[model samples]
Target: MVLSQNEFLPRAESTLARLEGAVLDALSHHGKPSVSSLAGVFRQEARLSPSQLAQALCPGPLSPIGFAALVMRELLAPVDVVLEGSVSEARVVTGNARAPSSLRVTCPLIVLGDLEVEGVLEDCGPDSTVVVLGRCTAWGLQTSGNFLVLGDLVVRDVIQGVYNDESLVVAGDLTTRFLDENDHDVTCYGEVHAEHHLENGRSGDAAVTLASTFLRPELWNVDLGELHHDALFERIQEGEPVFTDAPQAPQVREPDAPTAEELEGLDIEGIAAQASTNARAKDVVYAQRKTGEVWLMRPGSLPLHIFDGKQLLGQGTPPALDVKQRASERVTFWRKRGDLFLEIERFGAVVQLHAGQNNGSLRTFRFAFATPDDAAQEVRRLEARYTGDFLRVTSMIPGRGPLERELANYGGPKTEYTSAIVDGTTLVTRDGERQRFDDEASALSALEDWLAGKRQAGFDLKILEWKPYGLLG
Candidate 1:
């Protein structure tokens, strides 16, 4: 049931119209019409069947007008040959006692074997041995010895009388008009025109500027004879390698660097002796240098300990204006004229503990701590480890001269407004009521009228904690 080219062209034109007058009377008496006399007139007048008369005949041995023009072009272009290996879509006219080997045809092919053709191989006789693995358009591609086109041969004009020896590897483009010397060794890889004199044989590794500017330029045209266009353009800009051989140099080396026993077995430490007092040494507890405060040293100290690194705070001591005649007088003061004030106050408020200095003067003094209850338990452990806004005494009344308190941390809302402003115009609200704007569309129309509530009655409207201020010229 292999009939499908619209049912095998109307049953091969109704069995070639019932054996077309006995195949034109046996091609007028044997001019060539014997596949057992057309399979006995297609098994008795076209009832067909010896494999449908060998699928309507045309597998080799054809002559009666090339088998009636290949059965009228296979009943008008039916095409079906695709065979490989023991190929037999046959149409060879003679010459095959089996000498060549690899096959692979695909229609319109005559072969003994070594013929690859992937379609489009025409009239190749003269003991044909075609090899085209694809793309070859020939007319009288007569071969008596060799024709190994791996692709793109396209000869239509003057590629007269074929005769090949060994080297022939096309790989595309070899147009043809005058490549005589039995088509010189031929090693193409694209581009070869051949208008005239490529003298004789030998061109295996092709491409001496594509065999002298397109195949033959009369055998290397030095502008037709004397060599000088800047010495052939400096030998094709120094990349001279036309018929092959110049490719070697590529060996490079450079890698070595890790050695001190491969960087101590890869624990690696060598940026110029990475700190090694015989390794394993770490006693710094705390050390600071870029400006002030962290000095500490209890590991084996020489006295330093000014710690602001989580407070231990003062002891690099030395400036002693008779610090109460020293001898570790650790604290003792009641000076009304040389600062020390500590007042807390907030339970029933009486707050007044002033002490600012760093040159912003404000002072009052009254301190005593030669371990006054371990310095009031280290000032109640720095007011329970200070989490911002400080002051925390909440009841201490021992007063006869100095101790008196009741604070519990109080320092909120000291009224300083001006929330956001980093070149984003200005906004200030926390009830100080100040609006200075010329841009940011009048500070977003007074902040959308204080967020649509237009605030002001009993003014407690908060939400402003921004702080970067500068007023010093």
Candidate 2:
């Protein structure tokens, strides 16, 4: 019988452990194991291929250069050309040529004519170098050592320098899709252009134009410029747009707002019953379509709010006074010392606790709790924690700007289609029209259709995410 995944995993792990011990014993017996000796051990025992052996030896991540070197060593491959004598010895190529898919050079290399590399061009060790007298083209170019180009250098995908000892010098223009240089120097005598540039290293003389700058997680010390620390984190986590400016709000022409007469004729109670039956419904209220706009109403035919296709407009009076009183009684707030601002307010059935200080730098924060009692508990916790330090009260609560943006523009990274799931209903905004789906499953199917169309037009498919903000820590 075939073992289940749970059972198979343990057996697989134990087998791997035995294989590792056998390999280790074989290495000890051989003293200095070469590729041929390792192959014999693998064939006789584990029967692992060169690639699998490499993976077993280095399970986790390795630098691109290091990975390529390991693969070459496991395959017992030779370099395209070898330089004799010392490490400083030079190997010269007279004409244009495409380098091997993977190359590791121990000595300096000089190409008099244009050089093209389909894959990676890396160093065997530190101080191993490369020099191109003419233009150079590559898919991926990396160096743990030094590299110089007398002419222009163009990389289709990525070009990076490793460690503080490496230096990249280009006498002419440098162009790449992505450029990463950290703890090293990249000197360009002419212009430098990249689709995405990451620089945490020393800058050199070059006119640089970067379409976007990648902010890696490790480089938190880099200046945020205009963005706040929390805001930056939110943007990255939510997959929101960072490089571009805030998009202009779409000019939406909504249908006329439903008046009291329109509400009187419709069976609002029946609509509410249908909405309540949906398993995904969270809020007390539900929506019904009138004309083209959607109206939000409670079970008792109380029209609380209206959405004009895109924008939410408050039209009706607040919910019943009894409902408000019940919500208010659960929450309590007390400020002991310095001047601070705190208030409990309700939008529809949802209650929000707004807290902040008067200082301009300290922003007002809006916290949405499931119930007023929860909000009250949070308030008490924050008050007691910062009893002596009231000025820094805003630190506990973050601003709602990021959350708001995330809700309004809910789409995959670099997607133009705007979509959001509001109260169990999916709303997709494409072109100038807003399309509504009664359930999330139907909405996901619609989104997939759009992604399929994009894929047909030479673009990768990216489906919309319902609520990416839930991933926030």
Q: Which segments of candidate 2 are over 4 A away from where they belong?
A: 1-90, 200-473
Q: Give each model's whole-structure lDDT.
A: 0.32, 0.41
lDDT by residue (1-473, candidate 1, tens digit) is 22233433354445455554323332333244433344343333434322333334433333322233334334332333434343334343222122122233333343222232322222233232333334555321323223444346765433433344423335457785545444534456567876543434434223232344432222233211221222322333243322223332222211122123312322121211232333221212222222221221222223222333334333234222221121121111121211112232111111112232111223222233444355455544434433222222211111112121111112245533222221234544434445677775565455545533331211222221112231111
Runs in model 1 lying further than 4 Å from the true structure? 1-67, 74-153, 156-473
Over the stretch 1-473, how does candidate 2's per-residue lDDT look in tens digits?
A: 11123332334334334332322232222133233323332443444433333333332112221222222322342323332222334344545656545355665555546777655556543436565656888666666666667578997656666677656767678998667674556767678998767685533211022322343333222111121323432443344543444322222212223345445445554433443443122222222333323334333334233333444443234233222122232121223222233334433334444332222111112345566567567656644543432222211222211110011222446534332222233433334334577775565455445433443443421221222232211
RMSD of each: 32.4, 22.6
lDDT of 2: 0.41
TM-score of 2: 0.28
Most accurate candidate by TM-score: 2
